[model samples]
Target chain A: MKTVKEGEIRRREILDVARELFVTKGYDHTSVNDILKIVDIAKGTFYYYFASKEEVLEAIILDIVEEGARRAEIIVKDQSIPLLNRIMMAIMAQTPEFEGSEEIKEELHKVENAKLERLYLKAMLKRMTPVLQEPVLECIKEGIAHMEYPTECIETILLLGHMMFDCDTFEWKMEEYPQKIQAFLCHAERMLGTKEGELSGFLQMFGQMP
Target chain B: MKTVKEGEIRRREILDVARELFVTKGYDHTSVNDILKIVDIAKGTFYYYFASKEEVLEAIILDIVEEGARRAEIIVKDQSIPLLNRIMMAIMAQTPEFEGSEEIKEELHKVENAKLERLYLKAMLKRMTPVLQEPVLECIKEGIAHMEYPTECIETILLLGHMMFDCDTFEWKMEEYPQKIQAFLCHAERMLGTKEGELSGFLQMFGQMP
Candidate 1:
């Protein structure tokens, strides 16, 4: 039991070291010997934790995506937050990828990396999709409950997704930001035919959409 | 005279051939011999055209960015379209790098490459900054010209630039989108305490900020 616990702790330490070195020196310049020097681990021990550097990279990508899904779940579930605002918060989680490895960038062009990116995108979209549908649904429900009629709430919801939340073939460099995204949601509300004052409080709660 | 002109033409063809090769086969894999075989130009001709493969790469980067700047300028100046809409269109050029070179990713990290990136960024900003500023300026000008005083045009302009235009940082990526921008614009208009929507068309001009 003691040996097993010690092995698990040591493996975690190795992963931590690998991540820092990979992000800094990048995967190419970083060698097994470099990992050994940094982690103070034997070759056999390092192999025990990860089969190859590529495996380690796969792990990192999964970890980042998983963390994002977790964040999206937390933010999306808050019923007090309007659906539109929550969707924005969830969208906020789509941070730029770490640019440590040009190798990674190259891989993005390849079939395998493309698939991985698609999987991650799908995961991200799933978490936030409900945030998109739910709020608009609630808004309509509120209107209906109050005996107010929206001639086209569902169409409005779909339009909001298309104009604001829809994806495009154009490359969105999550890395090179030079401005903020607040006007986007506010303008979205306006275009959705919601009055400024009524939806103002709702729009304001996005707290910076993920 | 004929010999000299023929030599210049041959040299130009070699660079063009090499450019296509690099894009398809990548820089490292494509060699001088490969370029010679494809262009059917002699080794001497290839050497005459480019001192080395690296010089050709630098030239390609210059051409791509320079051409992009020129195109952006054209789009920004088309007065037939609404200025705000043009500004958003201008943003499409900004994202080209996201789907661009693996070479660029590697280059940005090296000291030489980092300096080059900074130079490129400065030049691109100089070219694109005018467009970013122009829409808001035009919106405000058009609004005030129509007697829309105490307006909230400034916030909308800034938010347009911050949110939709910039998407390159991990912070921007992580659910911390610059949401204050919405409040800043919305309240700025209301705080002016103006009755009626002097700025309603002003918002319309900016199109969708998202």
Candidate 2:
């Protein structure tokens, strides 16, 4: 392997330290001084990479969004995959925000401080929309062509599903059950008017077969 | 109509004043004195009915929960209605606790008062749970009976739907479009594994024409 660059290594170290400190001490509760002491980096160096604490947060969020967008696009493009399998793959691929414990807890605790919660929520919805939309839209096209579920309500279902996923705070416990997640996705595909047994096998493919 | 009792009228008037005030001044910022002032009652008179400000808040919540529970049960018992229809109707039936202009302004001025926000959130969720649960259980039942969708995930959907509705701060300009709401609900019901056209004619029933 080629030798790692000083800048890349240093920046990665900074993010790791910052993420831990932010997670443990909280964003508002943790200060620049604490980060400096923990990482042993000059404040100037920290400032060189990040203009403000908010900028660091912005970087972290961008990481989530960029990764989310990539995964969503990848699954959406895999047209040969069955709709339900693609849905399951998309879910596991995206992992959403809650899937990250350190990230989820820290963000929630710091929500009162960052003024970031609402924006974060909106970003989350936007992030997931394509992951859901691409497959559902394709499925709808097929369903309509074949005259499956009523065509009149297609857009309505899509928007509502989008809103619900955007806003709903399914208990954290539910995440513990992968079977449940798979089931729900199947339910969504079915509503889009996919034929039965067509997507049934997908239920077993998302995160540990139930 | 028969004359309303002085005590009953006075109590409801107090609850009305307290609910509005709690939303505005916040649970902590607005005290017993403020509620009494708004209701035009003396401190001792307020104490006569409610031992403390919390009690008055509790009374308001209890009223909401009781009414919500009653309505939710009624929806649960309707065999003629589709499962998705019941869930959407239940959501429509329960009043959403929107922060009024005054309340939003006050909270903005204070900024980042988490404890107060959490308390208000808890009280509101308590009022909302029954309104949210019936459809979840129904989805499970219907999914299993028809082998419709994964019966297991319905719980997560309900749990998430409640929290999202409670915590979501997005500007909802779309509620005015009842067709959109109907489409979303019908689709969501399908996502939970019910059949299409299950809620056909649902929009007209709500008095929204094609």
Candidate 3:
């Protein structure tokens, strides 16, 4: 039993070191040898933990999903905040941006990783959408009850928000990223039947706008 | 000179047959053998014209780009129509939906072909953007002059329109495709400073809406 626990710990350690290296050197540039060297583990031990570098990358993605779910759970349970705010928080929580390394985020945006990054995003969205859906609908219900949102096409607007803002499909310009976020938020707010500038503070709180 | 002209005709014939097979059978399912069977051409003659099946697909994509550019040129030159209408027409023209087979459109959307399709789209956008940029801007200028559209963020809205509508990134439901198009156009009209329902007739004309 102790050996099994130790093995699990060792596996996690390998993932931690590999993830850091992937963030700094990028997934393609960070070879298995580099991971072995950093973790000071033998080749056989590394192989025992992960079948290949791709497998390790996939494990890292799963770990992110798990972490995002945990964060979302906490935000969703916070009854102190308004339901709509909680929904926005819950959605933002699923994005890897909040606690993730900026360097890793930038590394994933490189041209060589575009295909892999899109795959990761699709997987993450698939995982995150279900976790967010019911909570968001509850929030939408509250918004409608409060006379703050339209009820005609609630589902479509939720999907639009998920695809357009919550996911990383749109490229953000470094200089104009805030402006873009503001514009998107304004549009989303309008679509949801929220008054203009209602969600502006959420954008500021999420660090997406000034 | 007569022989060269005949050879050119033969090359076009090969492409026509290959395109039809690719549309009906998909790029992966349509082997060079199938194209050969359809065209009844010698392997040597086929190889003399094209290097590989991928090369032929690339040629087809180039042909599409050429045709789209031709259509765009006509739409952009027609000053009889309103500027915003021309811009909308120019965008709708670039999409393969206007002329290509629905089977080919569906084939390009398959999971196995997602990467290849994205590459094709990126290539198409890169090639087509430059050709359409001047005319689009001129239309924007006309829109602004006519007070039908906003002036401050013309380029951004154009980019948004191209990315949101021209690309096949968003999946449309069979039943709700028309409704989604209407919502998108309404949002875009609002963003562009046009009055609501201003572009409804254009969507109806495109057969995207009843």
lDDT against the true structure, per candidate, is: 0.50, 0.55, 0.63
Q: Which candidate ranks first by DockQ, i.e. highest? A: 2
- Worst ten-residue run, lDDT, model 3 chain A? A145-154
Candidate 1, A48-111: lDDT as tens digits: 8889876666666666656665676677688776655665555454332444544544443343
**Residue runs of model 2 more than 4 Å from their true location after superposition:** A1-17, A23-29, A36-59, A78-84, A96-119, A140-179, A197-210, B1-17, B23-29, B32-63, B74-88, B97-179, B188-210
Among all candidates shown, the one with the greatest lDDT? 3
Could you give candidate 2's fraction of true interface contacts?
Answer: 0.31
Give the better candidate number (2 or 3) by lDDT: 3
TM-score each candidate. 0.43, 0.58, 0.58
Which 10 residues in a row give candidate 2 chain B its minimum summed lDDT?
B144-153
Q: List, residue by residue over A31-78, the lDDT tens digit for candidate 3.
A: 999999988989999999899997787687678767876787788888
How does chain A of every candidate compare to the true chain A by TM-score?
0.54, 0.55, 0.71
Q: Which stretches of candidate 1 lie over 4 Å from their true place?
A: A1-51, A80-133, A136-210, B1-29, B32-59, B75-126, B132-136, B143-210
Model 1 lDDT tens row, B1-210: 459889877866776776677666777788889988988868786777789877666666565556666666677788896764555456444433524455444443343343344344434544555555555466556662221221222323332333233322112333333332333233333323233343344444333332
Question: What does candidate 2's lDDT look like per residue over A83-126, in tens digits?
Answer: 65675466556544434336544564453533454445456555
Which docking category, incorrect, acceptable, medium or high, applies to candidate 1? incorrect
The alpha-carbon deviation from the true structure for residue A136 of candidate 1, after best TM-score superposition, in angstroms, is: 5.1
Assess chain B of each prediction and give its TM-score: 0.54, 0.50, 0.70
Q: Residue B26, candidate 1: how far off, in angstroms?
A: 6.4
